[model samples]
Target: MSSRTYPAWFHRVRSLVQDRKARGQAFRYNDDELPTRPQDYDEDLSERPNDSGDSDQSSILSDISGNASSEKARYYAMKEQRNERKKQLRDRRTGQGSNQSDDEWSEETEVQKELEIEEEEIRPIKEALTEAQQSPEENSAPLKKLGGRLFRLWSTDHVKYCTFETAPKRYIEFYDPKEFRGFKTYPDGKIDGHIYMVSDDMCEIDNFTPPKNPSLNFVRLDGNGVCHCFEVQFFDNHHLTLKMPKDLVFHRQAISPPSEAPEVFTYYGICEKYSDKLYRAKQRKEAQGK
Candidate 1:
């Protein structure tokens, strides 16, 4: 039997189908081989500039040969265009585009503005703290006026010493002898201690025993049985303020002892007895103002 002649297109299609079958068989038998199908092949010959002629195969071959260099140049140009398009897509996806950069700048500006506003708000507080820490001379000016006066503790609590005298280089504290009831006292009912000027605003009162009760004492003593230093907060002829190490402040007022004072009067008792008198005086003053 004689083999029949077939058209060129028919031969080409037959060859492609056979090639696909061979690849599929090889992929099945060997895991490393890849299967390729006829449809997966890119064969759009009509789009090729050299394949536009339909006269004969020789004419198509001659056209391809004549435009080989131009075709290579065109291929390279298309590849570069594709690469540029891919780079632009990547920039947009990663927030590196022009609009995204402007957004980032705006966010940074907002943060900086917020920090400036916070700093401005705290400026006054910082200045006030600086003045309070640096102006010890202003606080010490009142210390000189503390000497040669009888000052009563402003509190109503009956402490061991309710009144004190600030003598030259000495501090003399004493309680009312009659107010002790049964408690014993020294012959003079006074305890003397040396006072040393430590700094512009600080002083040390040494060689004095604090009250046995912790609450009755004005300041805590140090580990060496010495008194803790005092910070003179404010002072005048009639009033004195001292700050303790533990940040406690105590006030004292100058008082004139009465000629006929009660024999058994305590600090609290005196305040209680005179409270009504103080209230009546205030009421009278308010009425006079009206």
Candidate 2:
């Protein structure tokens, strides 16, 4: 079909071609196998120029070219033009038009290049991952006891402990004492291997931080009464007494000996605030306001 009657896309291409010709621009995509440039376009168009004007003259001599009944030759000639048009359309669909200059194609080709580069880059990383998966588990440090005392939180069903830090966030209990699993003690309680730590309070556990000082014996209230030590022994249901220092009384509210007193604050003994961080934050706000 003629360019005027053809589809919209074909008209756009035809317009681009005409515009290129008027502007003296180079031709890019063309059906001819031979390479063409702007200068070559004029030559190609000149061959078919004003075919209508020469139509009558050309028809007068056309009788000598072929017989009217050369059915086979006529069939092949028409087939050739149809095939050529199909090829042209296919090339445009596949981004293969010669009119598509290298510059324009470069932009389109860049997308393809990027995809190729991504695949290339991912290949090495994938190979490394495969190799890692095939390998055995990496050597890790053996978990050994790093001597530190443990104290349980207040009397509750919850399992929590306080390492010497400001708050408690650990879950430590004397492994039934007779379980042979010993406890790690603090400085004063660090004698040989036992600890005299205390349970301050409980909160969200994080690093199992150890507490400071906290020996069963303190100048403050170390007494002949009940001893303040990290671990307490359940001498019986009614009496949970100090068991670390064989010769010590696990003091309760009732003082055993009046003249002497057990240490009031030790790893075994704990003091708690109603709200863990509330008071401190409130103080800070007040100070800032001042």
C-alpha TM-scores of all predictions: 0.19, 0.16
lDDT of 2 by residue, 1-290 (tens): 12232223323334444554432222213223222222211212222323222223333433444554443333234334334444444465578876844344342353444334334423433454344346442332222222332332222111111111111132233222223335533233221222222332211112222223222222221222233333432211111223222223222212233333333322221111212243467658989999
**Which whole-number lDDT from 0 to 100 does residue 144 have in model 1?**
26
Model 1 TM-score (2 dp): 0.19
Candidate 1 local lDDT, 1-290, one digit each (tens): 01122224323434544554442322222323222222222232233333321234323333344444543433334334333434444465576675643344343453443334334423433454345456553343322222223332222111112232111011122234355447645344233232211111223233333232212113432321343444322222223223343211122223333344332222111121233354468669989999
lDDT of each: 0.32, 0.30
Index of the highest-lDDT prediction: 1
In model 1, the runs with Cα more than 4 Å from the true position are 1-174, 187-237, 247-280
* Runs off by more than 4 Å, candidate 2: 1-98, 103-108, 140-290
Please list the Cα RMSD from the true structure of every candidate, rounded to 1 decimal place.
Answer: 40.1, 36.8
